[model samples]
Target: MARVLYDLYGRDEQLRFSPYCWRVRMALAHKGLDVEVKPWRFQQKDAIAFANTDKVPVLCDGDQVVADSFAIMRYLDDAYPETPAVLGSGVSYQRALLFCHFVDRQISPALFRIVALDLLAAIHPDDRDYFRATREARFGCTLEEFHSPEQGQALLYKALAPVREVLRTSPFLDGETPSGADYLLFGSVMWANIVSRQAPVIEEPLVGDWFKRLCAAHNGLGDQALTVRDLGDEQSA
Candidate 1:
């Protein structure tokens, strides 16, 4: 049986936008695993109850069910030792872990502000109330206030300063080749690209170049992903 990856999608199922899910998607591809992506929405918590987690990026490999993106990545690496390493060396794996945390805790929150309204508009109708309630509580403001494009863009640039400096010298965060750390950061940017009408621009020329390289990876898989506007006729054109 092909592995089942439960990925979060918007109203249009093809527009898969969850950053965490993207990380796992790239990781699976990195390992050359065949996966069937099942589009999941926020309101469909019961659909993934078997995994005992309300969140997405759930991996069901036969009898084994893994929730959480990081856990699923580790599961893939451990279960399929013959495949290419997802985390790479011990030192590299440690660095990847830190980068993942940084992306989640630092980068994602900033990016969320810019895309919050667009994300709200794109989610399934059934999930609207749930998403709004949860996100409003987390940010302690209305969605509109939270989704201040200008402020969000400034925060995003500030948060990405370290990444810009690193890319100034190295091709990838892990040195020569793209590593788990690179995927972690790329996934965050993919979040902005998929949900927002205005994609956040990386100020550093090298950083922009690195993003283009990532978009061209896996035979242009990233570039081919459906953006929010792609769901509409105008953006599709």
Candidate 2:
């Protein structure tokens, strides 16, 4: 049986845009694992209820079911030890783990504000109500008020300062090579790239170059993702 990856999709089934899901996709690609990505919608909670979680990026490898992206990555690394390692040594692993946490806690929220409205527009119509209610509660504001483009852009730039500083000195967050840490941050940026036309500009030339390199990774997977503007163009004609 083929490994199954349940990925979050947008209005179109092919529009898989979840940052967490992208993290798992990149990690799987990094490990040279082949998977059948199943497009999952926000309203399809019962479909994934077997894993006891409504969210996706769930990996079902035969009888093994993993929910969280980080857990799934660790599972892949541990289960297939001969494959390329996701996490490196003791210290390196810790650093990678820190990047994962930083991307989720610090970077994702800032990027979320920028793409919140665009994301809402991209999701399946059936999921709109559920998405709004849950996200509004979490944000403590209506999506309109929360996703001010200017504010979001500013916050995103501020959040990315440390990342820019690091990339200025090294090609990847893991220094010389792309690692789990690089994928963690790349996934967050890919989230922006997929959902919105406006992306947070990295002031540093090195950071911008690094992002370009990442976009070209995994056989141009990031480059292939359609942005919200691209979707809009399709609808307009």
Candidate 3:
């Protein structure tokens, strides 16, 4: 039996809106691979001893330990070549890889601000006041200075332009079917909507249409909570 652990609750000291974990989950779903999902509590790294890399979203299949979302996704693709996780390795693949790198360097960091803001509100209400005071002195303004609505809009544009353009031309980012790029962008956009309540990127008609389509596809998964035992029990010996 194999188990996949994801940080479902970004509630406590966890990194919310994890792009990496989202990629792995989507890959599993797309490939029709059943994985046991273990949702971890914040500050429970010791419990994930098999994670070796000390990270969330590790997939343990028998004795094999899979870490790093991209690596895991690639491994799945190779292991299940019949379904093929990645699309063609032509221009589409190149573009997808380019966007993946851009997302890691550009969008992911900016999006972290949204998570940090949410954490401040949840974990340290008192520190919020102190942070504002000190942050102003240090950064020339408060947290709002760097994370203004105007800046958020710009961040959304820069982060989503590649995806929006792709969606405008094609049904999916890579091709007719969703690929790694779709998962990456979906996770980022979903995070924005959940934490910041803003998805300026998806407001565009083309991108918005694509989002609706994916939502429709995933509507059947429901909000069911899965445990390790369930996955292990169902796994073949």
Show how many residue pairs clash in every candidate, following the order shown. Answer: 0, 0, 0
Q: TM per model? A: 0.93, 0.92, 0.72
Candidate 1 per-residue C-alpha lDDT over 105-207 given as tens digits, one digit per residue, 9 for 90 to 100: 8888887887888888877767889999998998889998988777877887888888888887898876777767878888888877787776644545777
lDDT of 3 by residue, 77-181 (tens): 667778855533567556667777887777765655544454334322333565467546755755655555556556756777777776777898767877778
lDDT of each: 0.83, 0.81, 0.59
Highest lDDT: give the candidate number: 1
Q: What is the lDDT of candidate 1?
A: 0.83
- Name the candidate that leads on TM-score: 1
Candidate number with the higher TM-score (2 or 3): 2
Q: Judging by TM-score, tell me the better candidate of 1 and 2.
A: 1
lDDT of 3 at 15: 28
Ranked candidates (lDDT, high to low)? 1, 2, 3
- Which parts of model 2 have CA positions greater than 4 angstroms off? 199-204, 233-237
Task: Tell me which residue pairs clash in candidate 3.
Answer: none
Task: Compute the lDDT of residue 43 as modeled in candidate 2.
Answer: 77
Tell me the spans in candidate 1 whose CA falls farther than 4 Å from its real position: 200-204, 233-237
